[model samples]
Target: MTAGFEAIEYSSRDGIAVVRLNRPAQRNALDLTMRGEIGRAVEAIRDDASIRVLLLIGSGGSFCAGGDLKALTERERGALANRDRIRRLHLWFSELLNLEKPVVAAVDGPAFGAGLNLALAADFVLASPRARFCAVFARIGLVPDLGGFFLLPRIVGLQKARELIFTARVVGAEEAQRLGIVTEIHSEETLEPAAMAWCRRLLEAPTGTIGMAKNILNQSFNLDQRALAELEAYAQAVAMETADHRTRVGDFLAKKPLRYDWEALGRAEDGQ
Candidate 1:
């Protein structure tokens, strides 16, 4: 299935929904129209239970260059108007951040400013060898947006995040992996396939269980131990009562192969 839009392409198949930024001419730069289309795509994913994972990618080789500076400059708005515009962005961005299903970003080239933040929003970032990331807001005398304030410091340490933001330096794929930002680096030819493989692995897991765990984990930094314990207890209790858990237990008792085994999958993929 596909959802038609001008600035983005939304499609789903075999439980994976893809949101591809389509403005290749502008390096998939974010504009008001693209942002709105992304929001709509996200909404579609949220409303569809058949969609188990989201694959975020870009067209024309580049992931995204950042916001469209030309568009921003074409119209001058008051401080209040600017603030409102950003606030509107949060309406969709917040949902994307808290989305229950797994999100994988396959970045092939530059992901700058808001582009970088968009990739950070994903649970796993799969990058090509030539991929580059930059917190480029400082270059334009602006601050990071699109959940950068929340996601960047969490991925990299606060000090490193500060340095990246302050310097606006471009980070190559290898450096990004070292910083624990890029989950995996593949050759350009294999980036998309790797991302799809990851999604396939995730699809083997019990979606409800993973979603519950993800929900609780996303709040670990904010909640106290007591609060987290309560949440964990609740989530685990719910998970234990699920049919998927019962089926897995039955399989275990019957000495049958488990449906989801990460290590086994890895070994098979490695031809071990």
Candidate 2:
């Protein structure tokens, strides 16, 4: 299925929803219209039970070039107005960040500023060899937005995050992988396929179990051990009651193949 939007393309098939930034001419830059469309797309994904994974990518060989500077400079807005605009972004961004379903970002070219943060929001970032990432806010005399303040520091250490933000230096795909930014790098030709493969593997798991675990894990940094233990106990109790969990246990006792096995999936992908 597909939903038509001006600045973005939303499509879903076989449990995977693909949200592609469509403003290729501007290097898929984030404009007001694009932002609105993205929010709408995210809402669709959230409301649809059939959609198990989200694959965020960009058209025209570029992931995203961050905000459309031309659009931002076209008007002079008050500090209050700018603040409101950013707050609006958090409305949808927060949902995407805490989304129960897995999100995979397939980045090919530049993912700068807010673009970089968008990829960071994903559960896994699969980049192409030519992909580039940057905390470009400093270069423009601005601070990072789109959850960069929360996400970047968690992915890279606080010291590394500060250095990257201060320098605003572009990070190549290899360096990004080393810094724990990119989950894996594939060749340009295989980036999308690899991302889809990842989605397929995730689809094999029990969605409710994964979603519950993800909900708890997102708060692991903020919650104390006691709080986390309580959450874990609750989640595990819910998971144990699920029919999927019972079926898996039955399969194990019957000496049947498990429903979800990551290594088995890898071997199947390798044609083993």
**How many clashing pairs per prediction, in order?**
0, 0
- The residue-by-residue lDDT of candidate 2 on 128-165, one tens digit each, is 98999999999989999999999999999999999999
The residue ranges of model 2 lying beyond 4 angstroms of the native Cα positions read none
- What are the lDDT figures for the candidates, one per model? 0.93, 0.93
TM-score of model number 1: 0.97
Q: Which pairs clash inside model 1? A: none
User: Model 1, residue 229: what's the lDDT?
Assistant: 98
User: On residues 1-272, what C-alpha lDDT tens digit does candidate 1 reach at each position?
Assistant: 46469999888989999999999999999999999999999998988999999999999999999999999999789899999999999999988998889999999999999999999999999999999999999999999998999999999999999999999999999999999999999999999988988888888788888888888888999999999999999999999999999999999999998889988876666678
Off by over 4 Å in 1: 267-272
TM-score of each: 0.97, 0.97
Ten-residue region with minimum lDDT total, candidate 1: 262-271
Query: Candidate 2, after superposition: displacement of residue 242 in Å?
Result: 0.9
